[model samples]
Target: MLHVNSRTALLNNAAFSLDVPAKIENGTTYVPARVFAEAFGGTALWSEQERKATITIGLQQVFIHTEPHKHWRMSQERINVLNEKINEATDLSSYSQIRTHFRPYFTDSFINKIIYSNGIKNNAILTKKGRYYLQ
Candidate 1:
């Protein structure tokens, strides 16, 4: 179950605050596309040529048509922090920031599975650039 209040939402006891508020139209709730996607351990991609946005999670993918006239603010700070850390450090534990800020990402079951099954070994990961990431 999902619980939403204004710009904040909670799913599986993981809470997120978005820049935009959720909408209630006809008593139905609507959240931004990006916010909802990431909450479920998904990554979104936008294509200029196709005017579409795609969210990928595990082996599943969802596509949404984007309209040029409409304005949407998408925030990727959650992913950005993880990427920046992985890019800069040889170990995930080397991340200097407070862990609570990144709790959602770290505690995500899907990401843990990926880390444990594919990208990580012996508390280390080899990035595509051949850099070592320590857990």
Candidate 2:
């Protein structure tokens, strides 16, 4: 676990010291960009001019703003909600019910990864409207 105003992170009962201290504000814990990014097997590219960080892991990449912004915050909230919905679904039928619901939040590869990784079948039946049904 990581706490605010601390330079240490505890994992598996062992504490690892951080070069930059972690900070918490409004219940949000903020850590160093590069360190946080590397922990997730990603490389973080800090853009001083753009004031943002680009984290790339494998073929996936995400952009994070250095400072908080309202629009991005809303988008993140939506993503959190979509993730919750996806996790709650247990079967292909139920998952397909919300296909369009999370379309804006996930890419084809991401959805494919989630379904395949969960041991779900990939053979989905398609309809004329482009919706999927479990075969």
Best of the candidates, TM-score: 1
RMSD of 1: 15.3
What residue runs in model 2 are displaced by over 4 Å at the alpha carbon? Answer: 1-3, 10-19, 66-135
lDDT (CA) per prediction? 0.61, 0.63
Give the TM-score of each candidate.
0.39, 0.37
Q: What stretches of model 1 exceed 4 Å from their correct place?
A: 1-5, 47-50, 70-135
> Relative to the unseen true structure, what is the C-alpha lDDT of residue 14 in candidate 1, on a scale of 0 to 100?
74
Clash-forming residue pairs, model 1: 90-134, 91-134
lDDT of 2 by residue, 36-55 (tens): 76677778887888988898
Note the clash tally of each candidate.
2, 0
lDDT of 1 by residue, 1-135 (tens): 343557676777778676677777788998777776787788878799999989888789999997666544424553455665444333445444524444554555644554445433334333344333333
- Which one is best on lDDT? 2
Full-model lDDT, candidate 1: 0.61
